[model samples]
Target: MLSYARQTLKRVPSFQELLQGTMGSAKEEISVDVLVIGAGPTGLGAAKRLNQIDGPSWLIVDSNETPGGLASTDVTPEGFLYDVGGHVIFSHYKYFDDCIDEALPNEDDWYTHQRISYVRCKELWVPYPFQNNISMLPKEDQSRCVDSMIDAFVEARISATKPKDFDEWIVRNMGVGVADLFMRPYNYKVWAVPTTKWEQMQCAWLGERVAAPDVKKVITNVIHNKTAGGWGPNATFRFPARDGTGGIWIAVAKTLPKSNTRFGEHGAVTKIDADAHRATLKDGTVVKYQKMVNTMAVDSLVQHMGDKELVDLSKGLFYSSTHVIGVGIRGERPERIGDKCWLYFPEDNCPFYRATIFSNYSPYNQPQKDVKLPTQQLANGSKPSSSEAKEGPYWSIMVEVSESSMKPVDGKSLLADCIQGLVNTDMIKPTDEIVSTYHRRFDHGYPTPTLEREGVLKQLLPALQAKDIWSRGRFGSWRYEVGNQDHSFMLGVEAADNIVNGAVELTLNYPDFVNGRQNTERRLVEGAQVFAKSKKSVD
Candidate 1:
């Protein structure tokens, strides 16, 4: 089945060379000014920039047939779509916004949603940004948090230096109650690492990203029993109108010159001769370039280059895998769900750390309103009658599970367990009919911001840049502060600017500095044609 799908897709005009190279005997060698590895958002961003510049000949390649990397999406047999976890399109740069806007142009091309987020505690819904909303907590718990905040405020007055680790930073800012209740465990569930193992230097990303409590306001709210709303930069976000997040990238790729982009079999880069400035594809075609922009994970890139020193240096970095699970049900949207965007889970009641009301993103994410299907089972393990196929509308929920050596998961029954968890958490009703499900595991889901991460990246990145190779991206540079889709895309854009114009690569080096402001300097300019050839290409 996979082979037939590959063959059928290869017949597309844009994939002619890819098909010939994969199935035919004619292998070719070509050279360009630049070679890009990985067709994820970062790689696409670089390729798009290179195409705009028209300065250096370039070609972008990836192991996967489609783009998006960890930000991609998948569909179930019953026509339900789910992104890798809950992908929200919140941009910190105009370029990022423009690129997406250019791909999905119509008003109906996207779904704009206001963020409705919360933290699930002992049967209570704590408004997100837990530090600022202590009124939801029990009276005793509120007292503990307030006392610690006062103590931290006092300590800050006397201390001349900054906190040493994430734990200390939390204690110094949020106090003990909030930390013990939500900050510590919630972070662990998300990062898959202990708070102490994280460096304080990374706190800069959370500067304004996480809301700091206004002590006076909190006290007033607690006394008044007022609840806080979602507060922070990403209080609202956008999602693609179709094809999930991957649809956005695929559309972006379509806007680029066909000759410069490769996917599927031809996209796979099997061997890299760094000294020879050459890369070999699975079909035995060799491509040489003057400079290479690699967006693949640093470790994978090192292995492809066959460099011992680089591989050993990459070992200092650590990462956790992610499993995205989706559940599609046949019923009216639950009244309890309302318009919630995503919810955080800190306890062990469910293996997943977060769940998004995926159906809320777009009505088309599930089967059509008129499609007919049967119920597989109920949320409470009850069998539903095999009745006539009938449907009006459908909705879904996507859950994300982080896995590492410290936090292992049972892959065998993970889907079943997650479904049961949904029922336990009141996410779905006991007799709700289950219609579709989706699950995908990505090995490099997140780049851990461990205490040792900075030291290693300090040495590894420069060493590669010295070799005229710029390694930048989410996992490429290994900094979570700059690992989001926006940051990752800009990392590539900035890398290209640095290589072509000697512009300062701010996003690659100083994540805090770039993240602290609106970053207006990175906007797109009209008539900035970097490529000389016609944008049109022959199949």
Candidate 2:
């Protein structure tokens, strides 16, 4: 009986194909054990796990044909590739590491890089974790940061209270010098929220994430005119040897059952009837499922469901959009720009908060060293006389800008502004020939850890779960700390486990707990000997 049901279900037209059927042939319902929405890493993660278990009739659908979500990559007309931002592979989980390894198995499949990072201040490149490297700052700036650090240290030793806002937290830990110079301005640019509006709880993630300077060491280094070495967890990471970050997801998607996945315009979900366990696709087919995993932004999901209560609660969650801009140039890689992965921009010289030397990740990131293309214009907006399609080599850079109502951008001129900013920051030569460009706006980019965010998610998630719908993912849960690819993927994995078996999802509920330790035990198949078997089967 079960086998017959499974076979019949497979033959039934999908919600999408129903549109092509005759008027009377259009089905009123279709059924599956589980329906996963959004083909991003998180949704794919859920689908991947479901496939591994080989349990329950499951199907995954996404609006876009491609995968990767924000971690995806884009290519320029000139053949340059740029990721959404700077997506480096640095995982805290063996499971995630193993999964990526499985996707791109060969040594040539990856590029291991030592992070060459920097901060721009007063036209000088300072080592990151600006608070810890105050010795490199100008004498006056150093004095200010050092004095503030001492005061903060003394105050913390005696004071019985904790800081309340992000600004106070910065001053308490980094001192006024670092705060005034780097912390305050830089964070505002990146977060699109004033430090005053940010809560101190957000600082909990910054310890290992940000490098703190030792005053004595910094002073000594400054006196000796010495620069600090690389700091932070991602001082080294892996990148795909080919394609951009998106290649990893695309490859991972290939490992899944093709029949279980749906994409393109037909995949767009118009409405979801939670009570009926039904989802209406763009083509007017209804899909009924026993369980649903939604990866769309929670706020958007609420709107799609037309649930008044969920929508109201979701309003408490807030996020800022991201603008990714890529530029490919005609020339050899610059000498001054040697081996830098990404750089931070805090000053007003540029609207972008960060810039990655996209070409530095791989040679294929740009057009073949020999591909010829006419120059659109120089970096400075000047038309070049060189109609010559001459290029033996090329390099590219990608930049990210945060936009919100609070921090509005001139969209019409944002690309031009970013190019000018690149020149101002010496990232590009004014007369450098520009070969290609790419720009895209993602509406629900970064979920802000606003003071109100936690309160809302606390209520919203449980409410959805009570209705048998699991809203999980980057914007789905709206927790920035757990919103990375690994975290988001695990959220789905754990969510599925919780629904299938009564398992406690440590990563989803307690991010700090999962993040605090090296999670080595979360693999689908364990043991070194089993790796070969697992690899062969997964491949």
Candidate 3:
């Protein structure tokens, strides 16, 4: 690569002439057909598809030492694993499944989970699809909810026009009582923005992701004192049996040739010179490419390029930072927890919006029962009576706290607050020994689907694409509805298709179209016409 750079420099001596009076060492340069930034699932997907086609010379890179970007997991000193937030494998595409299956082919590599989940409401656990399970609420609350739901049904029968914003949609579909009691507070806690205020979120991003209550069925359930069945894409999901969520991407990255990937300090991209189609890494290696697939947050990418117009447009995009807090308890798994996978907290009683039993996902997620560990502190913040290490069958819980301008958190006290909240909600006993605690803050967490997002993306994306850059991923596309692991991965796949063969970027442009049905166009098999090798016609 260094020799190539020297030869290129010799061929074009303008760089040498300009640096005649300056002290500088020649930087190594490498070339590829596609330069992929960020070795997350999205970047991996692009590289995987490119490799499958055998047409593009591509290199995937990330600043992190590991491959999983936001979807990655971290481990505590005590051996507990925590994902960035709640994450489970629920696919909307066959290609995504094929790639994941390729990565972890063994049945033992994963544990399929039946979604044992609930919402904490009025100091009671309500089966989720909280709107469908209002039967569990106190009688008075149920009465109000049913009355408003009946009103919403009547309104739905008469109303023709669509809801303008997420707030209105919530009220129109779930009724004012459901909105006020659960939807409003839960969304606020998750998005860190009010659904009805100036920062009101848009509703188009929701493509059947949120369940609309079946009014008559819900009423019947209420009358019969029953709970609704599980709903949505994640009703039954899977998790890695060994590492946490991050393990999947790491395994996927291994499928790609190591020579094609750069990670850690070497992969940290410092600048992107779009005019020259070059990306400069932190190690001073310049990677020149015919096309680029950028998986970093689009807002950050625009600022890195120093494009004033794009930066100005990117400012309209909103996001919330996530603080993931984990607590490892030194005890047997409590019966109250049962097989519960994740639980949601909507009220102010907890700083976290949701909590997952990380230990429940897999036995390896926490240390083995024989692994002894000393208590860091009690759940109630008091010193443990015994500081000596102890052995136990242990369980762990991971909680997520959202922070933004509208909903700021006390960073220093957030972990403590979350632990105390567990006790308050009976998630953990006050005297439970916390053997491990982990806290991490990710700045670009949940991308907000604000009213202004479309206008900014319409302009910003095209401007970048004109320079042969395709920014697509969770934060890259900034559409939370299509921002899961599956969606993000397919975004890269579609971007590659557009770059190589000019296929329509369905995941990027037609989110609702893609989300409305199962997309089985491209499979890792013969006769999958959508993914066949094609001539490079986009240029």
Candidate 4:
């Protein structure tokens, strides 16, 4: 029944067929009122706000098939799960809480736990906020710390000017004893940059991050041989019960309209014509928009935009790289590691700055009890006695190693070095069975608040805003003070509001003001009435 003319006619291609590259031309064109790039907290926040308002046509795109940027989680082929690093839920805004609660709404959706943390020094576990628990140190060490504290207290009384750098700040506050013993080495490991390089960094973010020791209280505690309890807002935290932190973002993305979002390779932004307000995607699709909310790193954004001026302006910004390693061991949770949430390593015994008992956060963090996996090797570097696959209880530890041009790490031997470090630090027995291991590196990790940071951001932000492009995220703003999951989310929310209704970006402009207290005004369903129509105070 086939005719020659009928057989020659091509069928109309389906959307799925077009996406799969099965038929039709590869190029397309689209236009929207707002374009959001990178579906992390920042981009998602912008999209959420844009959806709330009915006026503008908007679309959000990300190169990644999934959301959650640096806040993402990953799983090993063996089923062991690990987050990019330590990510805990402690929010300043009700909108953030609302979004998370909306994503993970059921009572069984999360687990609430008290924070139990410690610092490893002198082969003894000392309560955190090490200066406040000098009592736990050896008697000679304790006396040395107290003497230095007294000297620092006296010096602080006579000093009139603010501490010039982080080193001086530490000495004036904690004295030489605590500074040399803990603050200096611990911070160096965490930042992968020396404290003496404080001129290239800032200490303003130290308020809640660092606990200032009270002279009288510290002395009294030392006299009584007491340990300090948990400190700061993260004293208690929550974790998603099923998938890791990535689950939160994925769930939140589900609440948004599918038509307004594009992910995967077709969504990758290849080139941005800031002048023409057009963005070319990898698949040769072009998107023209009135405004852009960019969540990608500022440096990356500049390179993509191909603006040499912006690229040169962003050179002053400095950052460190992060290496996240996870080790899955087949056994019951060790007695010494009982219920510890996270532990800080100041000594050289471990290459990692911190190790989190990731499995303790949720039973689902590792493979089910029934799944079987054979040991790759003994922690001591010995061959496994048995090659047969093994079943049963399992536990895992996640470690973070910081690196930069200042502090280099050997990528090839990193996993082996980390395992040996676990043994050297007494975190695992020499013969412990290691079932699975995971390693990932993020080039743009911690954004260092260099001495020149303020000057650079002042110029860069305004110049980009001139083109109707709002670069506003962790690296986008280059302000670590408001770079947590909660703050990053609000940055996008505020950016969208600014585009739509000329609202003030309180979180971006006034980090200290927003961080100092609870930000309850901005809710998902109910917009912030006060800041919604207020003009931005900062240019």
Candidate 5:
């Protein structure tokens, strides 16, 4: 054996090289008419619209190797798939639907399922939109909920101050009984905000979020012991048949020209020279654009821009972090969880606010029947008697737990706590063998519509626009009222249109108008017609 080793020295560039433009193949001063940051739904929407217009030089960049921000999916080493949380496709805009269909056109690309959601409370499963389904609750709960709703409804006719806060909104509409039983604890778990803080939370952010029960209809349903079937916009929704939700974005990205997109480490925005209308990438390449459509979190964009005044103003905005935990079990789907798409946990039994029957959404969500895997541990953390690998059918559950400075979580024990939560909530048995697990935390998960939200956005959005920056997306725009996938996508599409032809960004500025009706201003099929006409004109 030779005692000599070959020495290979690889030069790593310093931070100064990256800052001063000494790395990579990107040009020093590349310019575009429109520059989009982040390749998530919002960014893709902007790019799709820009490509459709065929009038501007545009480029879309993202730090992620693949698209989809919070909407992305992750697969464990054992082949179990999980999304960021529980994401269901329920479109409010025809343009949004057209864009999704254009991406995954085939009938086989999706799996449609009726919404079968429930709220777990007092060890009973109540139909979702809890207020409307109070009939399913225990006798005492039903009486309390109904009485309070009637009182609140009558008070609404005489009262004049709208609502002071979310707490007051719930009490004024849902009544005190429902608030104490479900709304209070459930929302606390989801938003990581205390019930008392609801008084400090604005009510406008709740547009279309909650459905107040019709007192007469609710009384009729309760009298008959009948269950409410379809209630929310997501009553009937679809999931991608493959690659999880990330598959949808990947398919969408495939439609855009690759030359106009940049991703991975090289595409991350390190700094933005708003004064110079330039953005610096992680690789030291600077992108100069006439107008930038920033899809990153507004706070994150502010941090990268290094703007002191904007940073201070952004302090008024508050957001909660999300912890997504996934558990893949090595067995067939259990009878208790049969066909239940998603379940809400309002009791103290579970650390998670919500749990989705992920495997039931699609067969591709779990591994094949033949894949072999050893049980890592039981849901309760007991050691497996046998260390050998086993195989056959499998099932999975995805859970979402919120965290913030107000609500701190022990990260080291989160997975274990989640497993225990599953057992406590009857989602999994103590002896259930867990094959795979996943835990991911997103910093800017839910943009809280705090009392100061309106005040901040009033000044913040216009300030960014003065610098030719359109900061729009879930976190970018900071509007939880219109923060769904469809709404986020349209925010980008509308932002692009606004930049190009002075079009109104209805989705951004007037969320109530967009959420309340079907927006059909543009169609994907019409886009093809326009494209053909434009090509003919050019020829």
Candidate 6:
């Protein structure tokens, strides 16, 4: 055993040798024109743009060994794939669409799934765009909702002032009945903010997030007992066929020159010296940069820089944590759950605000029907009849539970509580076999679009720029309105453009314009055209 141990030990460098190697690298000054601090969609976006320009020396680093950050996927030992949350490929920018297509060009690389979403309330599945499908609701609820919406329509004719907050916006467009029944409760669950705190959020972010019901159409639907169909950008979306959502990012990362990426512990940023224009990595390597595009949380970035005022200023930005739970069951895809993309849990039967039929998104998301796996336990927490391995057909569900100061989550029993909640909501049979389970909590999940968010960003972003640091991303910018995967990616791309030339960041400065309209300014097909024309010469 000692001889064998010596043989294994011989392959590894001595601590002294490792220390010296680290010291040697630390002493070497790695300089770049642009330094990207994260390799998520945002950082990758920045990196992609820089690579396309081919004029700047750039390095993109991420703490994780993988390329995707919050948008990454995880695989369970029992052969189940789950994403960070319910993420669908719904693009506002043609640039984003083109970039992803360039990475995974094959049509076979993705599975197109129609978004069949619904709200579970009072033991009934109400079709999504809840206000439009009031016919699906109980008669009492339908009557109340229609009556309140009629009152709101009448009230709006005389009221000239804008809504003071999101709560008021809901009351204005959706009416008090819908607000009380669905909007308010679901918002509280998903945002993890209390109804009272809804006033802290603004309505400007409400561009297309909510589908304002046409009162007449809704009334007609209720009268005719008909329902509504899908709405918004994600009405029909795409998911990668293999390796889950993370595969798309991994493919995109491969497009960039590998020499430019620094991932894993070696890439972890330990400290940032804004004055010196250098960043220290966890491996002790120091990077000197002309300008930095930071994709980390702004509050955390301030703490890393040890800037007291900036840290305090960043406090005004609100965000919620997300607990993602995945359940892999040893059974066939049930008829009842067929073709459902994701389901909402507005009622108290489930702890999760939203549950995605993950396996429905793609066949590759779960193990093949032939793969054998032993049951972990039953959904009811009862012992299985046998511990023997079983085969044929499996399915999975990915649920998201939000947590914030206003709403605390019990992390210890989260998985168990979630499974029970699933049973309560009839998502699974009490006797169903659970093969595998996964639970991970992301500290910075949804960036809250608070009333103070825009106010804080107005000051914080420009201040960081004064020091040659463009802090942008979901958390970096702290604008939930423009914090989707596409928006975040474009944020980085725009930031890179702003750094390279004096280009105006349309996505960053004018989110409403970008979100309201299709941004086709930068296209992959036009790359050759874009290449011939210098960005510096454009202005």
Whole-model Cα lDDT per candidate? 0.78, 0.79, 0.85, 0.85, 0.86, 0.85
Candidates in order, TM-scores: namely: 0.90, 0.91, 0.92, 0.92, 0.91, 0.92
lDDT of 6 at 347: 78
lDDT of 4: 0.85
Write out the backbone clash pairs for model 2.
Answer: 132-212, 132-213, 369-392
lDDT of 5 at 32: 77
Alpha carbon deviation, residue 266, candidate 1 (Å): 1.3
Clashing pairs in 6: 369-393
User: Worst lDDT window (10 residues) for model 3?
Assistant: 1-10
Clash pairs of candidate 4? none
Candidate 2 matches the true fold with a TM-score of 0.91
lDDT of 1 by residue, 214-309 (tens): 777877888999877667667877888789888988888888888677777778888888888888988687877667788888999889889999
User: Which tens-of-lDDT digit does each residue in 356-455 have in candidate 5?
Assistant: 9999999999998899999999887998999899985999999999998888989899899999999988889999999999999998889988999999
Backbone clashes (count) for model 5:
0
Worst 10 residues of 5 by lDDT: 1-10
Candidate 6 ranges with C-alpha deviation above 4 Å: 1-26, 517-539
Tens digits of per-residue lDDT for model 2 on 1-539? 01214444443344445555533344356677778998888888888877776446788888887988878888876788989877888775677777778888899999999888888888888877566666778888877877888887787778788776567777877778788898888888888886556662355445345565666677677678677777655777888989899999998888887767777776789999998889988867678887889999989998999999889888877788899999988888889899888999989999999999988998878888768788989988988897778765888889999998778888889999999999999988899989888999888778887666667878999899877888899887787878778878877877777767655676677665555533233343333235456558999
Better of 2 and 3 by lDDT: 3
Task: State how far residue 398 of model 1 sits from its true place (Å).
Answer: 0.4
lDDT of 1: 0.78
Q: Tell me how candidate 5 scores on lDDT.
A: 0.86
Tens digits of per-residue lDDT, candidate 3, 1-539, equal: 10112233221112233236232443657667788999888899888987786356778889999999989999988899899888999887789998999999999999999999999988899998799999999999999999999898889789988888888888889899998999999999999996547346889988757888988899899999999988877888999999989999999999987767888887899998888888998868788887899999998898778778888889899999999999999998899999999998889999999999999999999999999899989899999998899997899999999999888899999899999899989999998989999999999889988888899888888889989899999988888888889888988987887787776676787676566643233232322243233323332
| Superposition error at 370 for model 3 (Å) | 0.8
